[model samples]
Target chain A: MSATLEKGVNAFREVMDAPIASFFNSCVHCGLCADACLFHTETGDPKYTPIYKLEPLKKIWKQEYTLLGKLASMVGLSQPVTDAELEEWSPLVYDSCTLCGRCTVMCPVGNDITYMVRKMREGMAASGHAPAGVIEATRKTIEQGSPMGILPKTFLAQVRDQSEETGIEIPVDQAGADYLVIMSSMEIMGYPEFLGSLARIFKQAGVSWTVSSEAFEATNSGIQIGVSDIARQIVMRIVDAAEKLGVKYVISPECGHAYTALRWDGPNLIGRPYKFGVVHVLELLDQLHKAGRLKTEGKTDEPLTLHDPCQIVRRGGVVAEPRNLLNMVASDFREMEDCGSYNWCCGGGGGVSANHRAEELRFKSFQVKKRQIEGTGVGLMVTACANCRNVLEEGLEHYHMDTKMIGITELVAEYLKEDKPA
Target chain B: MSHMDLLIWARGTGLQLALGVFVAGMVLRFFEIYSLGRKPDLSTPRPGKAWAGWKTIVSRSFPHPSMAKRTYPTVVLGYIFHIGFFVALLFFAPHIRLFRETAGFGWPALPTPLVDAMALAAIIGLLMTLGYRLYHPVKRFLSNFDDYLAWTLTLLPLLTGYMAFHHLLLPYTLMLAVHILSVELLLVFLPFTKLVHVGTIFVSRWYNGDMLGHKGARL
Candidate 1:
């Protein structure tokens, strides 16, 4: 009856479907996913192979779903997945994996290893084997409205501060606005300038946008912790607020998984389409740029390269928009190798940043990004995700590199053109 | 049974048994998978081209440029064995004559020497594939009993056929009968082993490509 081994087994059976069945059936055991993973590449450990991490899930599929497996288990030929096995796999599933989709992309038979990892995490979390740090973050998100424990008053306080600093009235609870903007807790706490920049740019563009006090946080810790029920509740808050305000769009902040949870997984989690469209902030800026509404006065002449966030560009389909926005305000923008849909992950994504146990492994995996940025030989790196920026900043500092990380919105805001009197 | 009787059983009764199990097992497995069905995606898609799913099935046949260098050996050897097997199976004169006799139709086949050369190259390619699996640490670790079993099943028919053609180590009738029996063994195991990938690869690649394609991400 407890949320232990039985619950984990039941959850796997519930999640098993056509795609999962076929993926397991079709795997050729080529081990190509190992080379596709950063953890395996950097650590040279075979256990970190992306497909190998799904052994528990695969065993469940075989034992309960396949004919031969059923017969074998009836006679006790196959060992049942025990609590100890789940315990052993905890580090492999959470600590060593970032769900980066690199292996999914590179799989010869197209197994979508990252998708399976996300599903496997459901079993891990249900079995009480989830990392302690992620459990705390999910608890905070459910109770405090933000994974970092930022409450409504704290979010409003940051709103007030941004309004005072920008000398513009930042709208709150404004019904029937053109856009309802949501900020990640990372942005609210680490980079309040992102909100200030959005306010300034919206004021100049004459776009109607407001932040809802009820649902301003965009990041979903339920997704990070791999629980759909909690993720559904978190997404429901935004859906309710946006529908009540009758907004035209909900702008996802420059947080990678936040955008994914809202724009991609949100509707599916809720089991219906939202009245308001969900758009990434960069996509909105790119749309305004295309409409001739966004005007910039100057561009940075320093040679800079973009660090494509894994979820935003690769997983979120915001690939072209970032480049389109960066081209507008950066005069010397350069492309990094393997940029756009095939970019390496920041290694702190998919709840790894929230799990304190994964810190050392996260740092080890960041070596790939380090080598990528060092290859560009640029002192300035522009990224669209606040989480990617923070992770990149930590990695850069850890390696004693002085590459400055800036959000694309903040970069655009610095070059915003002033409104002229007609 | 006498040796001649054994050859007769393998050619007639054994072939029927193997073919029946292979077809029936494959259909049942395919049905089990397809019957699970996909859940509807309620999320709205970004504005882009539709049918990215169908496009992905074709596109994934070639490796993405970024991944090609790292996966060159597997891709190369995979193409070699697959193409070689097809050419040796479908285009050899003897196989065509068998088809013409049984199925009442046949296409023109390659010259006997050309088919012989292709079979030799394919056998070498499969050996190299096995060698790569043994030598590479990652592949060696990932390999299981099922993988080796599938490899042996696939390699046996080709090896025995080549031996019968060259008349190596045994009389022609004995080698030919062994080749037929080896092929029947492969037919029986095809649906049950990792060799099922031959049918499931397209299904998996299509599903993956379509899912990502709907999101407008390049495969």
Candidate 2:
């Protein structure tokens, strides 16, 4: 079946639990969350306030769960959450909100407004109110192996090209490798240099890793679209590939939500612990650096800044690893005002980048990030997430700014110390 | 009823009923929230950040440093309001006596003038809060009947308590009764409205902090 309002309402009921109940109950309409959200702050639009985006979900919670709400419904004192409301809220739920979690941390009552937005998307997606672009992306993710509809052949071709370019054999489906490396479609299509960078770094570190033909796509449109089952299908591919190959760890590429989906949410989505571990590329690189296996010749002389991907640093908890690795490669790295876990979003996360309708608002909200970059006065900006890199590049280009961008992995690879221990 | 009878009722049956509803309603609301229960996080948690949940419960009381300028009315004024309200509620001589009689123990009360100042500060903070709510676009847009109702119920107790203490609004017996009645109104509605946050905020903080902290993100 496609979708129905009943299904949407049922999905809302299914997702509702203690944390959400507490969050909804604890909200005092202080509106401080708006200040924490770039969408509201940049646009000065009250509708973009974080918690208000969940009005439909909150209504369902109130109508179905609360005693007063039940009585109100019975007496017709309160209107039920209608299909039209969900339809109207599509842009707010999917387009404007980026699941950045800035509002989650800033809520005075600790409401976790971003958490509710993630949950609210479940209803929105099930109700068929998800934006066309996102729905298409999810469809492509399920039908093809990737959201961008890049096939395994295309991925292997890119791997082969990178292998030739780097003079390193990019292993595919190699059994008994120490790590099963994954890549998001953005890195595959937009920045295939990442594969070359990873190959060089892993080779230098003496790491045995392979790209799985079945699970090379790291970004999960299912998670972006808020469907657990689809997310599970996407994650299970990696788990299966890892288990089949007996890889000890799975490397999440420089994609923000991809790391979160694999590291934190994968087991829960699949309802079982993975046989192998999940590590972000930065975490693995930092480990190699600390172990003295990974070394860089010299730091970049230019003053540069790092943009912390919300999912990778804040939500994924790979906070120190980026800084640890960046310290080795960047000499004059300046910190943003709220860098590391409290960093502002690139306005392109949580399927907003995938949604065509969100482009205008997304660009408008990029003002906060632009100010952050300008404040640092850094000509070069480094980030670990490919999605952030893409979004930040778009923002910079749209504003006609000349700030150069690089992935931390690629930046580190440029300075890789090639000589082996004698 | 005469003012004396009203005062007697407010102290005796009215206080008892309010206290009863407050306790029972809170218990029920807490059940409504906690009983829903969350799923266990099947993801491997990062070690060494176990206390982050409790830490955030206390830490979240302060505004994020970068956001402090923008959140002055909510955070700074919010602190003033909460501190003043709590001092008046918990430390005033009559309140302490009442607590001692009911709970079998009481701390030494604050100086009357200090408690009075705090209450005055809280009243001012609350008025400022009202002004902020009206003026701030986001808050104004988000505010509903329940928000304003909770605000009124909260302010009435503080306003009426101050009036009763000063014997300014009405005859002393009538004002005290009204004060007690205002508090009783707050008590009865506390569990149903956003005022329930007084209890649920801790739960919210814990859930948020624990989830993030489990992933090794300090909230």
Candidate 3:
């Protein structure tokens, strides 16, 4: 059936597995998650509390899963989740939450509030309660290869441009490469320098890396929309391309959620392990540096700080790599308070960047990042995630702060040691 | 029923029924939750997962530094009340005597003055906690009937026990019976209410720590 109330209820029932069951059971109604949430903190609205956002999902779990809840429901004592309720909750589920997962980490009971929110969005999306912008982005990701509707020709053309600009060969679909590198559309369109940087680094390191024309887009809109089926299909394209080329590793681009979708949730979403390893680009760069292949001659003189992308650093375990890589070239590197795994989200993650409806709220939530950067007192900001970079740039500009944002890989590539004569 | 008869009933039959419900309900609830069976994590684990998981059970007992700084009152009061309650429940002389009489086991207890101070502190801590729950916007918003019921049930035993010990509210037998019955009420409600957190917190924290630790995240 269509995205009806019954479909949303049924979806909640279907997804109510053990973690959700225990998470609901274990919640102590401690409002610590509210203080942990940037939305509630920034907006001063209790409704933005992470656990409160899952009221509908909790209702279904209680009614269907718990003995006392079951008894209450059978006796007609408990109120069922209504369409009106879902409608009211749609904004809380989609607009307010970036799914940055601060609350999950901060939850005293370890309730995994972000996981529940992600699961709750499954019902929200099915019931057509998901925001129109996210739904459209998902549609585009399914129809087009990228959420931004960049076709293969567009991606290839960008690759060609990057190759010409770098004066280095950018291989496309070369079989038996050591790495199959993927790029998010944001990088392709907004920051082509990432591809150029990768090309330069791979050249100097003498590494075999090729871009897959078939699966060049790394960002998964299905994940942003909270639809696992579509996310699986999106990830399969990369898995198929990487498998076909027999690459040793599939390099996730400088995108936060893209790294998460590929490195963390990809195997689970596809229900099987990949034929190749999944490594975030920063991780691969750090590996190359450790192997003594990636050599840089000098460091940037400007004072700089890093904004760790929540998904890549916090959720994906690439915490040390960025620091390792950043230390190589950033001599004046200073850390922001609450950096690394505890870093605040740039507020544009989890498809908020794509959802135009969330623009105002997104900017409001960026105040957290704004204060963080302000605390750092550094003009130059180096980050690993392109989305964080973009969001940070916007926040910087919004507040008229002259913080120059650059990709960490590009910074490292700029300082690549010159090739010596043979 | 006469007060003596009521005291006898509360001490014998009522205690048995409440303990039976408490133990059986808790076991069943725990079983249902644990047996739901988490899906096997297929992702590769980082090093020291077991250590991290166990460490998290202890570590989460303290708030994260950032959270602690922001919510010091709640955290401090929470520990005070929990420590006070456990000490009063297990280490107080009267409670130890009750346990020895009922279960044929006893342990060295704190001196009467020490236990008395701890009981008073716990009662004050619980009262502050309840007042915070009622007044604090976020806590108040998050609280439900379960939270208030759990709070009241937990507090009643300590309050009634204190009254019985000091012989303030009624005759010693009646007050003791009230204390026993309040404790029984808590036992019966323990499995059904937020009081279940006493048992489930470790499991939740361990799972969370294990999951995050597998990803190399420090909980």
lDDT of 1 at A373: 89
Lowest-lDDT window of 10 residues in candidate 2 chain A? A111-120
What is the clash count for each candidate, in the order shown? 1, 0, 0
Report the number of the highest-DockQ candidate: 2
DockQ of candidate 3 (2 decimals) = 0.66
Per-residue lDDT over A1-422 for candidate 3, one digit per residue giving the tens place of the 0 to 100 score: 26888888877876777667778888877788998888888898888888999999988877877789899999999999999999999889888887788887888777788878888888888888988888888888889888888999999999999999999989998999999989888899899999999999999999998998899999998887778889999999999999999999998889988987887788888888788998889988999999999999988889999998888888777888899988899788999988887788888889888888888888888888888888988888998888888888888788888889899989999999989999
- In TM-score terms, candidate 2 sits at 0.99
Better of 1 and 2 by lDDT: 2
lDDT of 2 by residue, B20-93 (tens): 99999999888989889999999899985588888889999988887888777688889999999999998999
Candidate 2 stretches with Cα past 4 Å from truth are: A420-422
Off by over 4 Å in 1: B1-5, B47-50
* For model 3 chain A, the run of ten residues with the poorest summed lDDT: A13-22
Q: lDDT scores for all predictions?
A: 0.88, 0.91, 0.86
* DockQ of each two-chain model: 0.74, 0.88, 0.66
lDDT of 2 by residue, A1-422 (tens): 58899999999999999999999999999888899999998999999999999999999889888888898999998888889999999999999888999999899899888888888888888988999999899899989989999999999999999999999999888999999989998999999999999999988999998988888999999988988889999999889889999999999999999988999889999999999998889999999998999989988889999999999988888899989888898889899888988899999998899999999999999999999999999899999888888989999999999999999899999999988678
DockQ of 2: 0.88
